[model samples]
Target chain A: MPSEFTSTLNSSTLEAGQTQLKIDGLQLNFGGVAALYNISLEVKQSEILAIIGPNGAGKTSLLNCISGLYHPQRGKITYFNSSEHEMTHMKPHQIAQLGVARSFQNIELFRHMTVLDNLLSGCHIHMKTDLFSSMLYWGKAQREHIQFRRFVEDIIDLLEIEAIRYQTVGSLSYGLQKRVEMGRALAMRPSLLLLDEPMAGMNSEEKEDMARFVLDINEEHGVTIVLIEHDMGVVMDISDRIAVLNFGQKIGEGTPDEVRRNPVVIEAYLGEEHSPYPLRSKL
Target chain B: MISGIFHSTYEQDMALRHTHAQKIRLAILIVFLLVFPFLANRYYLTLANQIGIAVIGAIGLNILVGYTGQISLGQGGFMAVGAYTAGILTARMGMPWWASTLVACFVTAGVGAAFGLPSLRLKGLYLAIATLAAQEIILWVVTHWKAVTGGVDALVVPNPELFGIRMNTDFNFYWLVWALVILVTFASVNLFRTRFGRAFIAIRDQDIAASVMGVDLFKYKLLAFAISSFWVGLAGALTAHYRSIVTWERFTIDVSVLYLAMIIIGGLGKITGSYLGAIFMTLLPAVLSNLGRVVKGVFPGVEGIIPFIQQATFGLVIILFLILEPEGLNKIWKNIKDYFRLWPFSY
Candidate 1:
């Protein structure tokens, strides 16, 4: 069913330079079933791009592919960071080193580590000193560690996670854990950040706060964001451009207003009771 | 203010300690270790030697399980390899003690690698079973190889010498073992701060995650096994030389279990805990033996009440500790110290 939705987007030719990520003709299959089929889309720099779809829509899979967790069998993922084109087919840490970072759908914070330590792990790829210096506690390693800590502390302060900084990540509340995950992603100093359902289980108030943080990150920090979200209201409010997926395929791509009136999206969400144009007012 | 302290350049922060209190404590510990053999009686000296040998084995096991997070039950087997090599080279071939010790360490390391090859494909319980098999095989070879190992006949180990001074006395052997234990413990402490140490911890926490983070698991795991085996082998060599005999029965599955028990009784991933655990477990039997003697002196029929009471006590102690304090005796020590440190405000 989702394969049919993605087939529609596969027919469109992707435009370049406007977005940092230009994914063209991406196809991924698990056994006999296609989890993602010919999904092509672009994410512009300094803009919040939302990928919205119903359950089992392969939204998380797209983020996983971009983060190098799962490599697509077909199609290319070309990302531009600081004017250099880089491929996402490399190792996850390699992608991170190239200034692209991602948070997981489920929280993957190092549970035993303190909140500060979890944030510190994100900076592991950027650490310059090797084992020798670390073991001996030599001058170079000390200086590099201090420098990185300062950078991490700045992000920690921005996220307002100072209260629980010393507490283990396992002890944190769900909303705080999500914020810590974001802080970890920010610690990489990423140019492109992919967030997989940042507010998946949050209360309405928590979602509002998260949406504010997301907006602040894009508008103030000028970081490119590609988020997979289920809440239509939040997606409609925050996203600069929206892409809708059904099953594993991209069914619609346009501005929020344009996607709102799309016939296929209407049918996918509310069944065939209402026409695509009236669903905008219903939303 | 707390952040400022932790914000020291990585080198400064990771430095074993920054305060004069720590320096003084270490100095006092060194002094105590140096004076212990002289002050203690022959029985205490022997107990110290056993603890020292166990400390060495614990350090080796720590490299595999603590630093690398790989479970291994083959340390006792590696120790057997070292013991047999030392026993054969010195007693049969008439090799110099130092040269034979070196050869024993290297040979055992090679044998350890042979067992480690299978570790490349296995992990957790499966890897543990593989090491368990190695333990059995090594014991079999040592017991059956009559020409070199003396088979069932215990191989007599010559008294080790340095500059023509025979290390035959309990005091002399105690010093040798203690010095080696201290050296190994210090080295292991430094090892954990290194890149290899981080790689091991990363693998332990999450292997797939570590691989994605640019760590080559197979290469590092093998390296961990080799280094662990080398140290364990050295302990075995020392053990053989210390006892002045090589008996296959001593390096049995029971000894392997004891080593695992020591690490578990210590904190799983800490160097200090390993040494502390080794000392505690090694001294336990001696303490129990003395207690048994006292009980027998007090009551004539007590020995008849339970023939294998010590063995039962050992198993019970391990179970009790595992249930009540899974973090082991090190946590208890830490808690006591913390309580003292914050005496007035202690919980």
Candidate 2:
């Protein structure tokens, strides 16, 4: 496993992970209530896979299960970086070490750490493991850090957060904090990135900026991203494929056009009584 | 004229010192530290030595509680391990101060890691309680163990000799204590510039988020414990040699509270704050005691009231500081420096 991971890591450009993220028969529970039940979907590699659902539709829960945050009682989540790997049973850090990075629904930026420091933390797996490196940081640690900092600086430039790069994350406005959050996840240089409502509590301008960043990260970096979002219009615009969930079960899964026209998907978004036309028009 | 540093590269941008003014200020500070021993009397030198020991131990505690966000009141316990180990090695087995201190550091770190093992299973107030339990256990062991520690009796430490030069005098010891203080401070300041320090901060902020970012929560938490204990242990070994004795009572729960107070009053997470907080806290008691003596002499009928007044003053100072500047002395220092940098236009 280590050799295979190293082989994939040594390559300068990402030239792999071109298989589907197959989530089959995923079941999670909190006490007795089911969070997700019998959920299955496939996210094609290098595509923006957006999971859309109502408030309690288990969108974030599915992402949690996929990213190995929540261990489900039943089901398997499989991904391919260069070869098939089981992620459902892995620890969150182990999954992340395999180049799967994620951001939280609520901003989880290290509030005390500076923006630069938070992003530096995103490269945790890439750094040397010895505590001595940090104790005497002028040698190997400093060299490796300056190298990663250059990469983080590029990300800062890309996210348009350079002016506030040295500021504490807690001091930033909500919109700016969200941008930094995305930048931190991107700093991992992950082959697969997961975002949970990247644009939550954002103004129109902030939402547009976040959307563009998502698009750029996908197109330019060629990173396979799975995002959980509520904004139907934004989800419809960027998603190469859409998976809709309702009450712990997947109701519909397809491309934007296919999911948009599907009766089940429309019904899930609206109600059984309401017509799907108004929702489609809103999108 | 150059108004500020113009960083030409990313490394320069992240360098610890960005300006000539900072370099100049640091230089002056270094000179002052070097010259301090000659200027001060023996009493003041001993007080300075106390501050030096407190500074190192406080930095260690700061790393665990401040940077890693793990609350630990077992600092004195770890320090006891170091002090006892150093005492046994140097006084009993006839080892050198440097070698014994180094060995004591590793021993204390191991004990500290053992206690920190439960940190992964506990957090916040629970973790604090667990470490508090560790402190109690360590203290119990140190008190009961007789032959090695001399039990309740003092285990005398011979004067540390570097190249056969005796360091019993406060003037000589001053150089050694302050020098270790400098090295520890330097290493700690550099710690945050690298990934390990950043990861610790991340774990402190949000463990789940840090895990998703690829930081091993278990490893970093334990590492935080070990690293912090190493510093406290080193301080312990130094104190053993400096005081020329090791006793179990010297490392009681009160010492742990004092160390925590140093970190809190200095600043929770900042290195400079820890140093300043140590200085401020270590001297505050002495200053209060002197003030109390003056009050007692003036009032004539307040023999029992002086200690109470000292206690009240300590609590009052902490409360006032927490209310006015909760960020600690580091924030105050930063504000002062910023104001000076902005000059006449300062807001």
* Worst ten in a row by lDDT for model 2 chain A: A3-12
- After TM-score superposition, the amount by which residue B21's alpha carbon in candidate 2 deviates from its true location, in angstroms, is 2.3
lDDT of 2 by residue, A107-175 (tens): 888898789888888877887736666767766677777777776777788889978978988998999
Per-residue accuracy of model 2 over B59-102 as CA lDDT, tens digit each: 99999999999999888888999999999999999999899999
Query: How much DockQ does model 1 earn?
Result: 0.20
**CA deviation > 4 Å runs, candidate 2:** A1-17, A271-283, B1-5
What overall lDDT goes with each candidate model?
0.78, 0.85
Per-residue accuracy of model 1 over A1-283 as CA lDDT, tens digit each: 2232212211112232256788999998898888999999988767789998888888988887887778899999887655545575776656665677777788876666677666666666666666446655457765665666566667777778878877988889999999988887776666778898999999999999899988877776677888988888999999989999998989998999888889898778634445557556657
Of candidate 1 chain B, the 10-residue stretch with the lowest lDDT total is B1-10
* Candidate 1 chain A, poorest ten consecutive residues by summed lDDT: A5-14
Docking class of 2: medium
lDDT of 1 by residue, B294-347 (tens): 999889888875448988998999999999999988899888866765567745
Q: What is the TM-score of candidate 1?
A: 0.82
